[model samples]
Target: MAILSETPELPKAAVSPQALVGAASPLWAYFGGAAATGLAWWWMTRFTPQNLEAMFETAAVAPLKAVEVAEDAVVEEIAAPLQAAAELVPAVTSGTIEAAETVEPVMGGEAAPLGPVAAELIREEEAVQAAATPVRPRRTPPVPPSSDT
Candidate 1:
């Protein structure tokens, strides 16, 4: 058998533009529909009511929690000083009593003997009276006597 050197050329089929468009239209529609569906799904997940509510709740709660913590710290700071003052109350009371016992009252040019209890009661009463009473305004200074009277 003799081998032919030339290769046979295949017939080129003529394709119409309408047929090409018709064939690709379904694929374009499918891809476009898939893209639209994917976009809708992303939008729904990103802006869901639950997601929005949680984001707002976190924003609201963070400041409230910080305020609560600051309030607790302020209360603790105030209480520490008050607690220290309370502990000193007994010592101060005993010292006042000791001073009262040693001090003698001068009444009508005579040394009057007064008890510590009586002194403490008088001091408390005076304090209460002073607190209850309102302060008086200052009096105007007296004018000089006129030269021609």
Candidate 2:
């Protein structure tokens, strides 16, 4: 009775590769994939900087680059004479030194040495300033009030 109660097992059915395809129709699936690709392309184009920097072809870009270099050359040509004139100007001129002047220390710090011309100029300046200022008379003690008053 136990053997009869146990049913015989049936063989498993074989599956073909074709049976693994998605349930959606082929046309709809293809269209959905194409739509997704198109959407990604549109999003990239819309969000990217001015459609990816206005791409230039070699033929058109080469001429513009040449013009830029020519412009730089023109500017340098125009500045040459001015630069030559500036170079001819001297930074220091000769001056006769009459006497030496001591350089005062700044903020109680160590004093710095001055060139002969600078010292002479400083001495002349000090002399001029001294001559321009009027000398004040020495103050005398006030006279004591008279005892008789």
Candidate 3:
């Protein structure tokens, strides 16, 4: 295969106007954000006593306290029907069934509790684990093979 000529100039890449983007962003954006943040902080301080100077300013938080009281009333109102329905329905759990079943015999002839049966099963499983004594396929003190010239 023949190589291409070096005189052929490569096409120029498209460029973004980053300076125009930066210039288009107004100074008011930062000042507006700062002003909004300051207002929010002031509002928060009105609700919470930040220092000894703020302890006297409890009147503004009264409206927020009223809102909290209304929220509790609304929650009780919303949950009333759900609470009534929950009381009417049964709450049978899986643990209840498991506890009931655990009293029955796991093995033949004699009945056993869950604790002893689980312990016996675990003890039996250890033998299966011990039979393997798992070995990893790795170079254990690798030796060089003898080579003939």
Candidate 4:
């Protein structure tokens, strides 16, 4: 006669990779979907049409304003030196002309008279005028018809 055990040994449940994955997949999907839905709902509640429009306008206008400011700054940076140069041009021109007028003419190791300078200036003016004039193409007379066709 064998002694009878008070409680039978229970079988252990086997956890497999496929079963674990199958069990966890739906749970993960459910939580992911719930989180996505909650986020969407929150987003919809938080941002009304007016709020969205305002946000879009802010997003659009900020960069444009920044670009405009940058453009203005660049233009100012570039224009300052150009403006200074432009301002100096007339002064430089007048100074050059005055210096040219005050310069003593020297030629052939002697002080030359003003007459030659005046004549040279006249010749330069004539040359400038000739250069400014447009040149026309010369026309050639038509050849006579050959006697033997």
How many clashes does the backbone of model 4 have? 0
Best by lDDT: 1
> How many Å off is the CA of 40 in candidate 4?
6.3
Error of 3 at 58 (Å): 3.6
Each model's TM-score? 0.25, 0.24, 0.23, 0.27
Instruction: Give the best candidate by TM-score.
Output: 4
Residue range 1-149, candidate 1, lDDT tens digits: 23455667768777655666764555788888999999999998897355788889999999999999999999999998999899888755887989999999856877678899999999999999999999999999999999998
Off by over 4 Å in 3: 1-56, 93-149
In order, the Cα lDDT scores of the candidates are 0.85, 0.79, 0.80, 0.84
Q: How many residue pairs clash in each candidate?
A: 0, 0, 0, 0
- Give the poorly placed runs of model 1, Cα more than 4 Å off: 1-50, 90-149
Tens-place lDDT per residue, model 4, 86-115, is 888765577798989999996577765679
Kindly indicate the candidate among 3 and 4 with the higher lDDT.
4
Candidate 4 local Cα displacement, residue 50, angstroms? 5.3
* Model 2 lDDT tens row, 1-149: 89877988878767556765667335677878999999999998888464434455666788999999999999999898999999998665333222223445447666788999999999999999999999999999999999996
Model 4 residue 128 distance off true place after TM-score fit, in angstroms:
66
Model 2's TM-score against the true structure:
0.24
Estimate candidate 1's alpha-carbon lDDT, on a 0 to 1 scale.
Answer: 0.85
What is model 3's C-alpha RMSD? 19.2
